[model samples]
Target: MSGAATSPASAPALVLASTSPRRRELLARIGLVPARLAAPDIDETPLKGERPRDYVARLAEGKARAVSRASDEVVLAGDTTVAAGRRILEKPVDEADLRDMLALLSGRRHRVWSGICVIGRDDRVRVRIVDTIVAFKVLSAEEIDAYVACGEGMGKAGGYAIQGRAETFVRFLSGSHSNVVGLPLFETRALLTSVGVPLG
Candidate 1:
């Protein structure tokens, strides 16, 4: 269907293949509202020896393809992770895990990587990986304890939320802030537009 013509009335609807409120809110900021929200059911376990970028890319594309899409629908999915060098820090399993993650991140720089995938109406898959480098000030045991007790980082990657109270810990950030939150808007909009998905 190369060079196929399409009409405005037949434009495909965008389907967001995630239920994360942060992602939904981020899309809204770009004036793109998904016609549907699907919670992608996929194993999120990292493959042994998989790099962070590859892991996120695989997960994002997996999610986008897992969702059932109609001929007139385009699916979008994303995966975000916090990486300290080659090590990937996932969501905290418990308070101790959260504390350890915070401690490991204290007074150091880490990278937040997000992989975004789009399954266009043509069934062509497009993926973009965006990374942001962030640095945290040295954290004391008291600060860790207080943050852990507050439970803000419970299910967050790297056991922290840059858009939340954890922002206080950030001494430097060198990339897309929204990527740290969940999705990278600049790349996302680009992917959507490239796929003929209309955006406001």
Candidate 2:
């Protein structure tokens, strides 16, 4: 009976520990399909004076572990941080936040950090971090106002979405473009592969 119920050599992996459509889309790009999606509710607040790299890494791991208890299946989780110096920027919840984020990011170089974690069937954990540097072209006051009015930056990390109209602001980029989008596929694929999550 147990043998009849078990799928061998061909079943898709466990679950994506996020509700983000972008993450799902990125996974599909590498042909690593998931059986389910888990939106783990975890405290995203950074500790007192936490560095951007540590913050992202902790968030990803926390999310992965939160979902691990939901099912017997392996879980994949990720987090992204946009930082200028020691300051970590998060998703904007309102217009003011977006405006401030855009102003801070204007005509400057910033670092985007993406942390990925996968909990394997063998109870082992694999993690990876991707860092990308992007420089934005100087933005005019009219352009910034218009962009704020577009309302695209709301709920987006660092108050901007590179895949959207904000791409116009990018004058130079070094490292994985996908990292800025949310997930870095190259690093993600390597992490998944290392954890025995076969990808086509």
Candidate 3:
């Protein structure tokens, strides 16, 4: 597509159904300017025995539907989870879990799952799930202590942030780098195009 400006009448209208700064910046990276930003309120509790892929996908769709009350706009929502084997690692709420998470992720491969929901103007919803594999280098006790001391691990999945200090700990990443950062550009851009969103 050309770098031409779409007419306001022809421009795609989307309501981003999330409040994550990382997700917002990612949309800006691909030149999508959402007509609205709606932070959805939904229970994030994982169902008993629910796997990471199913968990993220359900939440993504729920968030989109929960926040899409206003009519005439397309709604987009996403949910991401970090998994170490079958155990899904969520944002740590306590220091003990945080410590365990960091240690377990060290020198091991983990998967990050991101689920995306695109609700079209016609109320037709299309979804996609992206998985990224990452391996963390062996970390020293002192390094983990310093990282946890700074309180940066509190809200991040897998007890680390690839865009921050934890970048040094990543030895290999085998999938969509953007998905691990909270959004998947390739799948996201494709969804937007299907719903008539202009992209360059």
Candidate 4:
């Protein structure tokens, strides 16, 4: 019975440890569909004075380990955040918060940090942090007001979506575009491949 249930060459199932639609879409771009989507329930509160890099890295690994996985399953998790210097700008709590975030980012360079973690079939963990620099053109009061009214930036990190209307505001960008979106495809693909996950 045991012999019939096991195959030597069968690839382990991929489990995505997030429920974000954008993450699902990003994974599909690489032709990999997760066999299961497990949204890990972990406290994401930043430690007092935690830097953006440390904050994302800890969350990614925590999420990956929080999910239950079988021996034949590989878990993948990622966390992304926007930071202005040492300030970590998380999801906007309200319209007022969104407006403030946009105003703060009006005409300066900020960083988007994405931390990716993969736990392989052997339970070996791999993590990588990717950073992207983005600059926004100076936004006028009218522009900020209109953007706030549109409500596109609500609930998004840094109060803006680079793939949406916010793209127009970008004056400069350096590094992985996908990192700013949510996951860094290059780093993610490499980690997945290293952990024996098949990729198209």
Give the candidates in order of lDDT, highest first.
Answer: 1, 4, 3, 2
Tens digits of per-residue lDDT, candidate 2, 103-196, equal 8999999999988988877777788888999899888888889999998888887988999999999999999999999999998888777666
For 1-200, candidate 3 gives per-residue lDDT tens digits of 77987666655578899888899899999998777889898999888999999998999999999984455678889999999887899999887888899999999999999999998877887889999999999989998998899887889887778888888889999989999999999999999888888875
Residue-level lDDT tens digits of model 4 in 44-89: 9999999999999999999999999999999999999999999999
Query: On TM-score, who's better, 1 or 2?
Result: 1
Candidates in order have lDDT scores of 0.95, 0.86, 0.88, 0.94
Runs of candidate 1 with Cα error greater than 4 angstroms are 1-9
**TM-scores of the models, in the given order?**
0.95, 0.91, 0.92, 0.95
Whole-model alpha-carbon lDDT for candidate 1: 0.95
- Candidate 1 weakest ten by summed lDDT: 1-10
Candidates 2 and 3, the one with greater TM-score? 3
Best by lDDT: 1
lDDT of 2: 0.86
Runs of candidate 2 exceeding 4 Å displacement: 1-12, 69-72
